[model samples]
Target: MRPQCDPSCFVADHLKKVPPSGIRRFFDIVCEADDVISLGVGEPDYITPWHIRESCIHSIEQGETSYTSNYGLLELREQISELFSKKYNVEYNPESEVLVTTGVSEALDIAIRAIVNPGDEVIVVQPSYVAYVPSIIFAGGVPVTVSTKMSNNFKITPEELKNVITENTKAVVLNYPNNPTGATMDKADLEAIADVVVDNDLMVISDEVYDCLTYEGEHTCFSSLEGMRNRTILLNGFSKSYAMTGFRIAYALGDSEIINSMMLIHQYTMLCAPIVAQLGAMEALRNGNDELDKMIREYDRRRNLIVDGLNRIGLECFEPKGAFYAFPSIQSTGMTSSEFAENLLDDQKVVTIPGDVFGEAGQGFLRCSYAASKDEIQEALERIETFVNKT
Candidate 1:
């Protein structure tokens, strides 16, 4: 028998620098335990709309399982392009500028690798998604995080952006309606930030996966801003809005050069998103709006319930303008975010993600997803109140 090689030595150095996701750590525990009311996962509790699922099923029944083009099905890409044009007035040549990805996750990963060189500085807004920092690190880029305060309602200000700019800065990531915090920025707020990106000549990777979930005002697509069309790589998907997480369908829109570069990385790695998923996503864009609106309405209702419940329970939760998360300050409990989450799970059978898992700026908060059913949210809130009282 041949001697075994040490796995640690074979692992890439950049991969070694990244830590396991803090979001998944608690989720893994929740899976092992029963009778847990979980608000830890960011996924919607609802299933994909039947029409969307039916489309995938019909395609499978017809044996339409062949591998799609690396750019994904042209029909699907056209639908995606049209959706952007109709919704955000952002135009892209589906042939040259749209690259379908397995998920927004992959879209983000490829965007980083395409733009970043070793030691390139990528400014990440925190308490942002857990993947942003690691994606930068994996691409051998430095993640320079600018923390957004709760007092500012978690919106990154232009001064904050200017403070982080340096000669090494390559790009900035913008996610709003932001994950973990559920903050959404309006057009004026984004224009202020866009000015900085334009002046610095830096690329923008805008993650708008939760754009459809905005409750306060219309979502402003970052790429749609003046002077940002060519400078932005727009990433969005069906996971959050259309309830198609399992479909794994997403796309990126950008300058043709960047799209081509991203395709090179994606072709060699992912090859293409699944055909069934592409079909489902096409159906989503074509016929799923009514169903999506229904889900959004329910989410809006649940959002109100959870936010009100959290505040009534004495946890001062800021009103989440978008996405389905309620990020409430846990400082009142005199416990660290991790401790509060752990203790709540142990004592009250409720599951939440520690805010610091998203970033240091999230340290005194807890990210409680309101994506669950109304009953689940109510029960979780009750359990959290009980736990808080004891603490």
Candidate 2:
């Protein structure tokens, strides 16, 4: 006879404190179902452009499959640097200030680990991405949340920001054109937040992965703000914009010292992003703009379709200005966010993410990604309406 061992002893204490992603439970349910319409995952419906895919194939055929510099291919870095300079007026040295990462997720993780010390507080604006809180916890830093309100279009104000600052506060994590809620910050909104960050002498980790998906207004790069260039780690990548999520290539731009610190962690853990993906990304930056524009136009169309349909069904959806999600209040159904999502999936064969998974403030709401085709969005909307009417 053998004695059973406790798995807890093998896991790290910080990891044990964290819960599994709220998004994963629904994913498992989805995988088991048949003929289901889903609005859960935040992925593009479009395929990678042929030119970009061809670039990767060409690179492999040429036998360029070995590792590059830990900092990544200089040509890709230079392209990234040039894009930032042309689009957002922010400049970074390709050699020192740019570090190509496995993904924006990796860049985010390494940035958190590079800066946070034990007992330090990192302010996370909520209803935020599911990864932010866990990443902070893993780095031995406390996550202090400041909830953004729907009344303010989910944009955090300087007043809300000031309430959370303390002597031990080290950084703030921001995701505008946010996930779960497609709220975006205008220049004035970000400028107000910038004032608070400067006054407090805090660092910022800005994830602008969805920058190219904005529909209503220009995407403001946070690092472009006055005095913010040096203190901000600007994270962006090809995942959302170029329909290259599978490639897992992204980059971080910041002061050389911070980039160097993140590089130290990257060289040991990730080494460098896949060279083939890097080659694909280089092609994306150079020649994929036309295909990207077409996809954006289609997403805007779907955004209008879903938001209108949700409101017509009495769900009370706010118009999302950027990204591809439609967050609608389920309060009229008299069900909690979780109850509504679960019951809808069970009753109508449609899938959505309960908003509370993003944060406590997300209760009474649901996140429906409009990244599916027009036909799928229409069918999901109809199914949701049927479920809502029956309730």
Candidate 3:
């Protein structure tokens, strides 16, 4: 046998630097358990709408199985263009400014890699999505954290934003109608942040995957604000809104030059997004509105149910107006987020993600997704009440 090199040596330094996702450990534990209710994954509980599925099935039956253009199907791109114009009041050249990615996840990755040079610092607002920091690190860039507090409902202020940005700073990643916290920025607030971005001469990668799911207020697209469209990379997808996560379809929109740059990396690496998924997404943009509205109403009902249930049970939950997560402060249990989640799963067989997985600032909280059925949410709340009371 040949000599074995040090195991660590085989991996890239950046790959070694980042830890595995904290969410996955609990997922493994969940898969091994019986009769467990999981409020863990950030996925919708609904099925993809039948019309959208039928569109894809029709395309396949017609033998439209070949690769699409590196950009994407023109019809899908035009639909996305019309949606942006109608909803966000933003204009995008469907032929030039839109790049259909494998998912919003891929759009984010390619955007970061395309913009960041070695030693550049990317400001990441936390406690945000788990992927942002590691993605920055993976791109040979530095991730500087700007922690938003519960007092501000997790909206990053211009002051907090200014503190972390340095001369080496290249970009900022924003997620609103945010994950975990369910925080949303009002239009005025987003405009204020837009001013900071303009003054700083910075580029922004705005992940609006959850934008359409807002409950209390409208989601002001970052690109819709003055001067923002030139600098903001708008990322969205069918995963959350249309309940089509399995489709693996999303897109990035920006200035044509930046879109071109991302396309270069994407073309060489991914070639094209899946044609079947593109067809499904086209139908989703055209016919999925009613189904989306129904799901949103249901999510709102369950969101109200669980948030009230948690507060009644003595765990403090802020009213979340966006996304379907209820992040309840578990501090009174006197356990770290991990300890609380672990013990609750073991003792009660109810699964929730420890908030600290998102960032260090998430330590005192737990993210309980309300994307499950109402019955499941009711049952999970009941078990959580039991666990909290006995503790």
Candidate 4:
């Protein structure tokens, strides 16, 4: 029998307009190909440090697998509070001002929902992460994009911030030690942007997932600035720093009122993050510094290797100051970013991300992650050179 069709369908209107993320398509294609060297993925190639993994197993053995309190385990929240205080010079009362989430990804979702009403404007700087735009749209807020240029090293200037602010601006999404671009804002840059933020009475959603992975300088927390703490929702996780991407644990810190509001949304949406993962994250916070230091040293080594190798191959790349990515200009190859990525994979069996996948500002470039093995990076660079020379 034919199914009866109704004019009123089940799918939400927002779902119809939201396009699938461009980053995933190349990832899927690369997984299906043989002998491909992938520098496309942003995740660390290393396994989660042994001790961190052991903590989760130990928790399970102790029969600690039940759902935690709706916000999260008190122990984990307290650990997060201590870590933030010690590392970033930010203070938060764990019980009232922190919410554990299923990765910085979910923390961002909850923040968007909590602060942005329908038709509100959420400002995002370009060449940023993929999730910000869709998250804003899903929350019924309009995304106002401010394009940043490579000439500026991809950092958003205060003048740029000033131009974007409007009465409807609810929040600005800040991704530092940024993905894809590998840009980090220094203290001066933060102060300049904070001036605009403060004057406009705008909120900041600071995504600092790559905070611990910085290379050139120490990461400066926006929340640590004077008067900014009350207006910033700081998002961080164990994914990049501790090589715990699969742990599915992250946290958000903000004013108590904002955190409480987010908790209400989080409880209804997800109930809680996995209890076992929270245990893993707790151990990561408590005693994972030595392992994290070792990992960061290795990433720094790879970062220099890949950047130098690409430059030697006649590809002009900005020396990344943070994160594990190299955003290299592929304009010399006479191909668009998409064409360069596709041709490199098809012809050389080397996979990288098209910069335009990030945004229009990324059109003439490609993002190569240095989170792979040293040998893998060397091989990928050679393949890229071969492809570039021949084409």
Candidate 5:
């Protein structure tokens, strides 16, 4: 018999400490169940706008199947630069400040890895994207989780920010129009957090993946705030905004110095984002605004429908001003998020993720994405209503 070593012995120690994504369990269960009305996944049901898909097909027909430059195609970068300037009044140099990546997920990983040193504490606002905490850990950094309460509409307060800072702190991760809760921070809220960021002299990774899906007051780009652009690694993408989830193209914009360092890590790991995806992304940027607006309008309609429906059904749902999720408190249901979601899936064939999967503060809540079709959203609401009534 051949001598063998344990696989765990070869695995990176940091990764061994990180937990698997809590969101995926429901997704796998739904995939195996029949007649499931899934509001568990965060992806938009809309196909990549026809024009964007056609452009990708065109790129393939033209045999443009090569890898883009490690920094991504120059034209795509230039368009990204322009998009930021036009929408948020923030200027980034296409050549130096933008680093196109595989997705916002990849950009998040790269940002954490580039700046976080061993023993560094990265302050992470929760409940947020599942990747934030684990990514910090995987990069040899500790994640200091700060709970953004439902009482404040889940916005991260300046006081909360100040309390989490320490000498070991190196960066803060902000996601708004946030996940799970669908909360957004406006300029005033962001201005306050900016003060904390600047006073502490910490770097920030702002994930703005859902920036375009906002349904309330303006979505303030954190980098646009005073004294933030220099320290902010702004991450945005074509996935949620353009319904181009499969494209796997996103970009990070930041100080040239920081972007340069991220580029070094990116080039070695990813080599380059796919050329066809970049071309399609460029087309989406150039021509997809009208389509995006249409999608947002649909999401807005569903948002109102679901939020109202959940509240009517006895769940205490706060108004979600951005993104497409309705985080309804399940405390009144007399069950934990996991129990409520599991029973709903088993009895009603409706799938929604338990909110605690996002963070500890997410306990006693459930994240129901309205990014599904209007029919699906309406039906899911009805099923959820029935489940609530029976319980």
Candidate 6:
């Protein structure tokens, strides 16, 4: 029997234009293979440190399970305020300028929706996280992509940024210790870009989710820059730093007025981040730096191992200064990034994300995450070596 349906099928017009994420398609295939060693996922393999997890258990046992304030628990906000000041030299009033959301993911959505009007242009640097473009479009803004080259170590320059700016540009999205690339911006590089941003009066959405993972130098917060504090929305989370990805707790800090506006959107959309997750995040802010430092040290070791291993196997890889992923050029393989990734998964049972999944500019490269165990990383490297040699 044919299923009955509404004669007027309902779907938003934007839904037709929005494509499914390119990153997820490859991940789906990786999930079905039991023997696969996946270097494709972005999150760490480590469990959330015991102390942070125990805090949440304590909260529940104390019957602190009821809903907190819409903005989140005041104690958590106060903790975040102290941590930001101590670590990044940035100041925010927890009462008005800080907002706790479901994750950095939700904070990004709120910032975009609050700041962007329909048809406005938002500048995005690529290859970047998979979420930025779609989130911009969903807020009725057009995304203008600025491609960063491998020669430059994937760092976007002031000249490149200036070339893309125009009257319609509303915001510039910055991600340091970037996903997929592991590239970071130095203070001088940031100062150059800040000059342009301040001159143009553009808002900056700085995503520093991997701030604790930098290898070469300290991670500089854009909001900490001169004249940038009011105009920048800073996105960060417990997921990457505390190995609490499942907790889904993050926050946005910015000008009080801007944060208030975002809070309204957040209230309607998410109500509040999970109460347990917020408690866990608070504990992370209070006592998780040692855990973070330990993880960063491990990631640094794995980073060197993977980068050196790729070079030995004849793949030219950029030595990433931050984050856990390594982006390597696959030009010698005579295959596009997509083809190389698919064939590698099928032939070697090794999974990785194609750089082109990040953007067209990422075409001849692949991103391999070092967030796995040392043993798994070694095995994956051996398989990659064999695959390259045979091909």
lDDT of each: 0.94, 0.94, 0.93, 0.91, 0.92, 0.92
Compute each candidate's TM-score over C-alphas: 0.98, 0.98, 0.98, 0.97, 0.98, 0.97
What is the lDDT, from 0 to 100, of the residue 12 in candidate 6? 65
Tell me each candidate's RMSD, in Å, in order.
Answer: 1.1, 1.1, 1.0, 1.4, 1.0, 1.6
Error of 4 at 390 (Å): 1.4
- Determine which window of 10 residues in candidate 5 has minimal summed lDDT: 13-22
Please provide, for model 4 over 1-391, each residue's C-alpha lDDT reduced to its tens digit, 9 standing for 90 to 100.
9989986597889878778887888789877988999998889998999898888899889999899998899988898888878877889999999999998999999999999999999999989888999999999999999988878899999999889888899899999988889998999999999999988999999999999999887889999988899999999998999998888889999999999999999999899999999999988888899999999999999999999999999989888889999999999889999999998888999989999888888998999999999999999999998998898
- Tell me the lDDT of candidate 3: 0.93
Model 1 sits at a Cα RMSD from the real structure of 1.1
On lDDT, the stronger of 1 and 6 is: 1
* Model 1 Cα lDDT, one tens digit per residue, 31-92: 99999999999999988999888888899999999999999999988998898899999899
- Clashing residue pairs, candidate 2? none
Relative to the true structure, candidate 6 reaches a TM of 0.97
Model 3 lDDT-worst window of ten: 4-13
Question: Over all chains combined, what TM-score does candidate 5 have?
Answer: 0.98
The sequence of per-residue lDDT tens digits that candidate 3 reaches over residues 79-158 is 99999999989999999999999999899999999999999999998888998999999899999998888877888998
- In the range 1-391, model 6's lDDT, one tens digit per residue, is 9989984468767656678887778778777878899999888999999999899999899987887788899998999888889877889999999999998999999999999999999999999898899899899999999999989999999999999999999999999988879999999999999999999999999999998899988899999999999989999998888898888999999999999999999999898899999999878877887888899999999999999999999889999999899999999999999899999998999999999888887889999999999999999999999999889
**TM accuracy, model 1:** 0.98
The residue ranges of model 2 lying beyond 4 angstroms of the native Cα positions read 1-4
> Global CA lDDT of candidate 4, please?
0.91
